[model samples]
Target: MTTYQETVAAEATIAEQAWAETFGRAMAAVAGCFARRETRATMAELVAGLLMEVDTRNCWTLGQALGHPGPHRLQHLLSRARFDHERAREEIARLVAGELAGQEVVLVADETGDAKSSTDCVGAGPQYSGALGGVGLCQVAVHLAAVTATMKVIVDRALYLPADWAADEERREVAGVPEEVVFATKPQQALSMVTGVLASGLDARWFAGDEVYCGRELRRGIRALGLGYTVGIAATYQVTDGAGHRWEARKLINKVRPEQWLRRRTGHGAKGTREYDWAWLEVRPDDTPGGNGNGNGNGNAAGAGAGAGTSVLVARRHRYTGEVSYFRCWAPGDVPLGTLVEVICRRWRIEETFQLAKGFTGLDQGQVTCWNSWMRWSLFSLIAAAVLALTAAAVHDGSERQPRLVPLTCPELIRLLRAIVLSPPARDRDHVLHWTAWRRHHQAVATACHQQRHRRHDQP
Candidate 1:
């Protein structure tokens, strides 16, 4: 007779095996990116360390956790390893597309920043980072994420280089920035990544972003690709009505009749359903064939043109605070207010992706200072994150049988992997002594360099 405990144990074993198999396949997909067998092995181990519960997933700590004698091997993997990280990123996108085969998908554009104390790091400078809550010294990277009903994964990323950094040859050489890499605005980076992803055969119905992406060029580019968009806009942005009257977004919302505002639920939150009052007004498309006479950039002359999609300015008012937000929306034909609200809600999925990637896969934990090292570390971290996300989605799909159990989350899945699949951390005396010696040796070198600088200053 099969007892309850025996049944539970068998299920647990099956789950562990499934997760291990999925992880292996993900690593195998990127194996061709590395030419050397040695570097390939190091890359696998580095990804494993990122998945583990290391305090900080930088080279030093990750090397120690992986039972290496020192951090040199991992450091080489990040800096000078002969591997194609860009190709690996494309492989990741392919893997995700396969995993989300039948679900409806959308492309989401967003950016995240990692705070840096010093300016030596590549692309680090004073910038407006939501991660830091304001303008601060950080390295910001624009990312494009693919979102489905139950899954979200980052498909592409580009580091934002400030204007000053691009013009400074000395800093560029020191940081190993390529000559072709120049200053690109966040919106431009988003457009480039989106275009590349679409060209790579990833099908997406719509594109979504924040205000940074609501520019004339970006919107035009999105339309050219034949994808609908729902992007945020500032309150001060101007629009034109069918009667050739121009009105600011904030002022235009007041004209909406009291009964016209409908209460709609965006999605579920921790508390409950997130409901808000919504209203939309049809506006003019800015991507007309020729220039409009308004000179305000709104295509008022293209009103009711053949094959032109419906353009509208949508507004959402909070249920409690009454604070309103705005969005510029477009679809092939007229879409319901509910559809626009849903797209607006989906834009927030990228924020959740950033949080999960940083918390579970050490997305922002790299300590690299050069362009190549930073790119390699970020790509590997994202690969690790993608694997976790795919595994969790698979687990959640089979969770309906147990009504009492909550859906499997990335953090919880990681905890289970650490317990069952991953090897226990090495705590032997020899392992501890090895890492201790390595740290002290590096400390000595850094101290000597500082002392030499001080002596040179005194001599002058």
Candidate 2:
């Protein structure tokens, strides 16, 4: 009979192998995006560096961690390297879709910002960044994520350019912004990304977003693609109730009877089940003029034909704070309130994706200023994140359940990956001496600059 310790060791080895194999296959799927063998190899190394633990995931540190003499090669990979990052993005979407096959999928849209100190960076300006918690100088990128019960992965992204940035030719040239690129709103960006992902043949049942994406264009666009939506709307959004009366979402929801509100669990959380009181009221679809359900002015009416679809205004109240939120919902048939609430809850998954991508895969750690470099770095970081997510999902599916043990998570999986699957950084005497000399040389140059500045100030 095998001893308990031996069995445990064997299982651990198997788990490590699973992680290695999963990562290898994911990288291989996107290999075609790079034409030359050398570029492909460098791309692989850059991704590996992103996966490794580094204080800052710029070319300098990543190059050093990967045992390189200088940051030139990695910098080139982001800046001037001739590789099809757009194709790579498509490949990433397909890879994620394949991994999540046979699962209920919801396409989620959101944007994230990286704070910047200077306006020299492309798309960096005073903007409202939820990540920054207010208006700040930053670069915002809109992203669309595919989510399921147990997995979430970002499938597409686009950099948001402010109006002035788009019109400034000199600054655009300096930042390498393509001439064809122009200013598009966040909802437009989300619509474009979602359209591209769906056009790539990735099937999703619903599209979800926050209040920012609750515009008529995006809603009608999503419905045109034959997908339902449960998008948040501002409390003041106008809606026509079933009685043909127009009222603000908040005012309309207040009319709901106390007994009509049903308490339902959205999903399981760290604490326990997230339960909320939900209520629904039938509403006139906004596709028609005056929302009268009569004439179509935009040629995109919700439920254009009889028995085609249904639209409703849904509200959710917190069980504790009693604070209420509203959503404008549409579905093909008369779906239950629970289904719409589930989609509403899944909107939070994109936020979770932002956190994981930034934390584990260095999604927001790029130091580049040019447009192409920024895009390449973001795409590579996302690829690294996808690898971790796929590995965690695979490990959880295959591993035996133990009492009192939670399922494998992306962070824990990354720890195991660095510990076993990834090659350890070189720690030999020669390697250590080289890094030591390099750091000291850098410090010497910095000290010289500081001393020169102080001398100039003293003389003045």
Candidate 3:
């Protein structure tokens, strides 16, 4: 019922078609991401699957979009997606260093696991669960992208999760290692990608990530690389003060900045509504007495914690109205605290990518196999997503005294959706669905949702 409109806007040339062009450009840019060309399907078939329809055969096109090529495209573009994302990230880093983009933006890192049925996938196994429904053999990967000026998402890293099931030599053989790909910890796989992106000779002011990647080694790696970082760390994991007195990040926030703890700010209230106080200090992690997360060697937590490193830590005070809350940031001590804070906040932009890719661009709907086709399919969806956003941005060019950085509204979203669905040769139904009618449909949906909530006694 709900849809994206500006994504479907009209254009004279496919080249001039801003949304379509954006998708095309992204695909072209990521074209060489693969080392071998895959025959999954042609690029056209990939794009068509999303635009028109998808069947079993055409699904390979979507794989190409994702960075996989069937034996067909593998010869041309068949490598991991990390390389492409890294290249794009390097571009963003270059822009940042050249002062073309803001350094105060967030560099969010997150990993999403994909459930797969095939045990033969080069990298797939049952591991820690992240999805809501259940757990199965799945691949986990972390993506790093920069978010600034309320636009732009450059994914720099894509690390595949390698489960222990594939760790043993026999298991590796059965799972089929090509000899080039070695056994690596999930964190290591992710770190390699992160390091590569940074090694791309690009500079970023900060980095942020979820807990899976917030391990001590990862933090230490970032710090060693001289970068700032923020993460949604476990509340139970503690941080020690210069005096060697340790307290959980959550406990410290509660003890040091109680008022802001358990703050409940969401959506619109997130921006401008809350600001943070910044502080920097030395940090050392110790495993809690037992079974915490530090893996036993360290005394911070149980199974996982940053091992033996005195790193720079930042404490941020988040204030909601009159109450003040707290959070600590960890990074290479040399970097400024402000830079770390800026980068940590940028992680929010990735949420937009997920929304657009799945909800707006229709990337999540694919049910195909083979690495190549999957890659193409994903790429097409990604390109389409970027194009829609860019076109919507291009639509507004006014020099207002106070310009709205967030361009495009729900109306624009719907407009883009309608554009693709409504083609040439207007039908009788098209005449019935004029601007007025469209607006009414939009209002009706919103109103109906509200009424439904009211009926359920959960009206907002």
Number of the top TM-score candidate: 1
Q: Model 3, residue 48: what's the lDDT?
A: 37
User: Least lDDT summed over 10 consecutive residues: which range in candidate 2?
Assistant: 295-304
Number of colliding residue pairs in model 1: 0
Deviating ranges (above 4 Å) for candidate 1? 1-15, 288-307
Better of 1 and 3 by lDDT: 1
TM-score, model 3 to reference: 0.60
lDDT string for model 1 (1-460, tens) is: 3454454455456558667877898889999999899999998888877888767778888888889888899999888888998888888788777787777788999999999998889999999999999999999999999998888888889999999988889999999998999989998998888888876778887999999999888887787788889999999999887666789999988899999999998888899888999998877777543545242453343222324666788999998999999998887765677877888889998999898889877889888999999999999888888887877777666534344444667777788789888776666899999889889999999999999999999994
Listing every candidate in turn, what is its Cα RMSD in Å to the true structure after a full C-alpha superposition? 2.8, 3.7, 13.1
State the TM-score for model 1. 0.93
lDDT, each prediction: 0.83, 0.83, 0.49
- By summed lDDT, the worst window of 10 consecutive residues in model 1 runs over 298-307
lDDT per residue (tens digit) for residues 1-460 in model 3 = 1122222222222223544544455555545643434422344334433543222223333343333323234323323323353344344344333332333445566666667677555456776555524567765545556566545454443436364544556645654444566666656665675676565544565667766666767665665666656765665766765455776665554444444223322225444554555544455443222224333233432111334322444445445344322334654324444455556556666866765566545554554333443444455565555545455444443212123234454234435444553222222444434534645776799999989888889644
